[model samples]
Target: MFGKSLKVFGILLLCISFTGCAKARYAAPEPETRVVGGASRAEAFRFTPSGDQAWLSWEQKPTDEEYGSFILKIGRANFADGSPLPLDTAVGVEVVLWMPAMGHGSNPVALEKIDIGTYRVSEVFFTMPGDWEIRVRRTTEAYGVEETALAIRI
Candidate 1:
């Protein structure tokens, strides 16, 4: 009887020791922000600029090394009352690729206006592969700096 109790105690002690000596675990760091204003998690490939009247979308990313890295984007904007922006608004757009984990950004991208509301983003080079934020900005005298950002894992 004593031997049985001792065996049970030994098993319990062994289990307790194994559990008590477990190594501490750590988790990967989370992205500081989801998008633009840095609020809740954003899962958007399309976003609205600061003016809250413009919508933007990005396409053709994750470029290969052999081919030049570039991104294509499109936008549509309207006034406060939802009227489309005038043709003479003279809007300009730019793209900036930033890696938040490393606190660094890629080379300045070349912006080519494809049409009234479309652009071909070029020269977007990334040093390392990690989570990146693609910041898109549209500027006009009336809207000032209408900007938006989207987080993506590359």
Candidate 2:
């Protein structure tokens, strides 16, 4: 009985030792952005055939001018790779309706941020219905300012 109890105690000590030495598991870090051609895009655009809704995600950075400090580890969901963007980052979106053939642009449409990395612009109906272009301007400190124009025939 004494020998059996000693063996059990030793096994318990061995298990405890192993548990203490186990390493913690953490999520892998994200990858860095690579620029190709003249422009590097940290944003993604998705337009549906319904012609009523659009989704955009762009990277933004705000720096402290006096201190010259940047918020570190701020992550924006790479719409291209399906990652999560930081919550505190500021992003501004604008929508402009342009008639390329007519050489005129329409009134500004309001954009709302639905989540951390998604913006929704609704009720984008063209008045004349020809070759209408939607120019989306995304402004952020990280990427400065970038504009994308999408053409649709209604």
lDDT of 2 by residue, 15-80 (tens): 999988866566322222222122323333332221122333223221122111111112334468
* Candidate 1 all-Cα RMSD: 11.2
Please identify model 2 stretches exceeding 4 Å from their true place: 1-90
Report the C-alpha lDDT of model 1 over 49-146, residue by residue, as the tens digit.
33333333334333546223333444334446443342334366778888877888987777787666545676666666667877876676776766
- Predict model 1's lDDT versus the native: 0.56
**If scored against the real structure, what TM-score would every candidate get?**
0.51, 0.43
What range of 10 consecutive residues in model 1 has the weakest lDDT sum? 35-44
Q: Give the whole-model CA lDDT for all candidates, comma-separated.
A: 0.56, 0.47
